[model samples]
Target: MKKLAFIGLGNMGMPMARNLVQAGYYVYGLNRSKGKEKTFQELGGQAAESLSYIAENADVIMTCLPQPADVEQMLTGEEGLLQMNIKAPLIIDFSTVSPSLHTAIETKATEKGARYLDAPISGGTAGAEAGTLAIMCGGKKEVFEEAKPLFDVLGANITHAGPAGSGTKVKLINQYMVGMHTAAVGEALHLADQSGIDQSLVYSVLSNSFAQSKIFDRHYNDFISEDKDEPGFALELLLKDLGLAGEMAKESNASLKAGDLVRDLFENADTNGYGKKDMSVLYQYVKQQED
Candidate 1:
């Protein structure tokens, strides 16, 4: 059995870890929240209080943290994974973080005989639940192939994009499109109301048009199916990803007028306390404009 240590047992991480355990890996999960750990244990995963224990014992260490700061704390903080005598060569990061930070961690991990991969994911909570995420990875070709089965268990479309940090670069492009489409959805809904068209009719018509997109489908899928709204991917996280897109554009000496414009729009909403809402509430941003 290949022992695995999975960190971050949040909405997305929990199911991902469960899949690995279901696939017959000896899975150990690390979570700061005791409740999360308890749930993981309930799902047949072992819980460890320390990253050291996970790093020391597991054959692979996978992280699904929220931010670059969290990733840094787990890798270099007290009782960090790097503090262990790592017999495992694979350390896969599933967070959407700065490419530079990913590069820095990869450099440091390589020095300690550990291979690192920046492998941010898409597919939202539904994808996590259905095990059909699109994973974009940046790492050496050999390491990526070696880890293919593990990613295959978690995602449907796994692309080994290129060398270190490139996965995150691809992630930024992905977010930029999402932001634009979300903003468009907001505007289209607002316009439909203004023109007195039935909301469902407009959506149905657009759903068949050339402008139709996965993002459009994403807006209606889960929340539409449930008739109630919950945060699968929160607005704050999308706002953060948009900000990263702005930064990425600047670093590449590329102009991101549209991305920056969308970031500013999301920032405005977040500033007004809508940060924790579903990103589809971009409709509210349009509402604010009408008011």
Candidate 2:
């Protein structure tokens, strides 16, 4: 049994680290946020003294941070993974970030005789809570194979795309599509409600017709039926990921005007105080227009 140090105990990370513990890994929860520390401790997990402490103690390290810069700081900063004296612990980064950052982290890990896996996830917070995420991963074949079972415990679909950075590449594509679909859902539902039709009637028709999608099933109905806007995935975070997707596309010389267009939609939501709402709650943008 490996000693796993799981970092970032936010909405996504907390449930994931808890899943690993339930799966029988000797896991340490490394949360810099002291508030989360007590919650995790209440659940019977130990918190390390510092990042360097986890770096020194963890045999398998996984992080679910928010950005590439945070990932870099975790891997190379003063209290970073590179500063720790260890011989080849497998480090899994579950952050949504650039492929270049993935590659750069792998190089740094190599210098310490350690290995790294870039695994950005999908399926939202509901998926995270249920351990049903779709994990797209990039690393060496052997490393990916070794990590696949653990990923399977956390997600429904775990695919090894290629070498380091490829997972982030694939995730960028996934996020672009999700962003477009979310904006479309918002716009279509808005128009449907304005047509003098009952919101439930419109939601049901669209959900059963060819116009339906996971977003429709999850939110269109929820919006009409309950006005539920809990954070299965946050709007602000989606905006951040979409922004990263646009950046990744530009770096690859790929065109993603659809991604760019939706980026603005999400950005507008953030600016209008919908940042804290669930990503699906972008419907509020349309609802506000109606009001």
Q: Identify the candidate with maximal lDDT.
A: 1
Q: What TM-scores do the predictions have?
A: 0.96, 0.94
Q: Model 1's lDDT to the true fold?
A: 0.85
Candidate 2's C-alpha runs over 4 A off are: 221-224
On residues 53-92, what C-alpha lDDT tens digit does candidate 2 reach at each position? 7777888889998767888888887777788786478999
Tens digits of per-residue lDDT for model 1, 178-245: 99998888788788889999778877898899878887777756553344346788889999898888
lDDT values, one for every candidate: 0.85, 0.84
TM-score (C-alpha, index-matched) for candidate 2: 0.94
Q: What does the lDDT read for residue 16 in candidate 2?
A: 90
Best-fitting candidate, scored by TM-score: 1
What residue pairs clash in candidate 1, if any at all?
none
| Candidate 1 regions with alpha-carbon error over 4 angstroms | 224-227
On a 0 to 100 scale, what is the lDDT of residue 153 in model 2? 81
lDDT of 2: 0.84
What number of clashing residue pairs does each candidate have, in the order they appear?
Answer: 0, 0
